[model samples]
Target: MVTPEEIARVPKVLLHDHLDGGVRPETVADIAERTGHQLPVDDPAELGQWFADAATSGSLVRYLETFEHTVGVMQTHDDLVRVARECVEDLADDGVLYAEVRWAPEQHLREGLTLTDTVDAVREGFEQGVAEAARRGKVVHPRQILTAMRHQARSLEIAELAVSYRDRGVVGFDIAGAEAGYPPTRHLDAFEYLHRENAHFTIHAGEAFGLPSIWQAIQWCGADRLGHGVRIIDDVDTSDPDSPRLGRLAAYVRDKRIPLELCPSSNVQTGAAPSIAEHPIGTLAALGFRVTINTDNRLMSQTSMSREMSLLVDAFGYDLDDLRWFTVNAMKSSFLPFDERLALIQDAIKPGYAI
Candidate 1:
């Protein structure tokens, strides 16, 4: 059995995490104060609780409302830098040895920072943060996945920017936003450009929407992975008390090996899952779909990798084998180079289990 303490000490890889959504409230308050941005709530604890309450209320509209404040606080170069650095530190402390953080650069251009400047600022912070972690003997490495909002245009430009920065810590591309009515096909040209350039990207789908969204993200837009993808369960059936199995869509996703970044707490908060006990992650993992656990919005979900693992431990009674499979799934789905992925599995993950 994988004890909660053992799970915390297990080296993990995170493939689906949102940079803006993960910001600590204390960081948000400091940025709000320095930039004179009026936040609805000033106290970090209160603000954090507000987000937790709003997101977990089971309404997608209410859940998204929490981000308007986080986006506001992230409008300046300094704001971007601080959040990016702190995010790396926090992930490192949570036992994530590697993570790919994504956010839309165009959304942060309100306060005089150009699109390029915003991307660079975040990348600069990532570099500085990784160095600082190394100084403290932490083996955390992070990569950026530049995103372009699905509703707004400029995805192609962001796609090009991501490819350009492939040498400078940027690893891939992504598109995030409200899923309903904003199909990833709206960004086909951008994905086509990324495909032509041999760059990697993932799309937010099967979240706050249904199977059609997942279909468009995979078949139409060519996402290498599916973000949230909880609604894929809609296509499957568990009506039977025993031997519940995948539907066509679920089978195809598993057969094709499309990585599903499953955020249990976030899914519960957004009503994608009824609760941790009902989350499909355990079932999907057991069924051999490439399921990777993540903290979609740590602050809003009031979760970390440790908490997510702990919930699985208690709810699903998963053991170390389950944890190893989840870690391997995340590592394989990561846009990091193949050699590095293998090295992490061999050096960090395997040795941790030997303890």
Candidate 2:
């Protein structure tokens, strides 16, 4: 019977946050003015609501257009530095101890910035924020994940960029954007390159799309993890609420222990799952899939790690053990080296849960 307050204070790790998607509205407005980019809304709260409305608008194209506004402001080095710094503060404030911010460098080159410059700017911000958090008495570590758009043709390039920045706070690589039509197979060359380089990446699948996307990402592209893998629940037959039947995909995900980055609020916002209560997380977790809760977009979904945990506590009556499972799931699924991850679980996570 852990209280929500207790859960909020517990340390957490995030695996599926988008750098552009999580930009605060006020930051967006300030950077837009500096970069001569006019945002659709000027008021921060209104703009926040506007982004959320558009993201949940049910049209993929329209939903994607929202990023145009976010990415528009994040063109310059200052913009990246500020956004990354604020992102660290926000995540630390929400009790996130470690997080990976993913964004495509290709999208931020509109104002004549190179891939290296962008990464450098973001790293600087992360470093600054880390120092600021220390002064604020919050201990947290933030890292970057370079994302390559699946529809576009620069995944291999992005993969190389990620490898180059590994020593500079870059943790891994990912392929995102328009999961419905753009399959990961289209980026097989990039995946193969990453695989050869011994790099880690997660593919956006099993959310807006279904089993085929997940299969192609893992069976075809060799993804180490699946982002927003909410739709993997589709493979389960729950005709009787008392008993559920796990289909081939669900069984494989379960038996193979494929980590599913489950963003509950974002899933409902995108119509991937009808509601949090209807979300298959509890069932899937009970059945033993390595499921990790995440904030797909803090601005778009108006969510945080605490909010996500609160919802799970409300919907499923999940106790401390359940929270431990979720946290351990994320720690295990992280792209960090095996030894480091084991230490976090054995030291930080286990000790934190002892309270």
Runs in model 1 deviating more than 4 A are none
Off by over 4 Å in 2: none
Query: Candidate 2 on 16-72: residue-level lDDT in tens?
Result: 999898999999887777667888888888999999998886555666788888888
Q: TM-score each candidate.
A: 0.97, 0.97
Give the per-residue lDDT of model 1 (tens digit) for 1-355: 6777888788888988889899999998988898788887899999899889888788877888888889999988888898999899888888898999998898898988988899899988887788888888787889999988888888999999999999888899988888777889988999999999999998889988999999888888888999989888887788874787778888999999999989999998888899899898877877788899999888898889989988998999888877888888899899988998889889888787675
- The whole-model lDDT of each prediction reads 0.88, 0.88
Per-prediction tally of clashes? 0, 0
lDDT of candidate 2 at residue 305, scale 0 to 100: 94
Q: What shift in Å separates residue 247 of candidate 1 from its native position after superposition?
A: 2.5
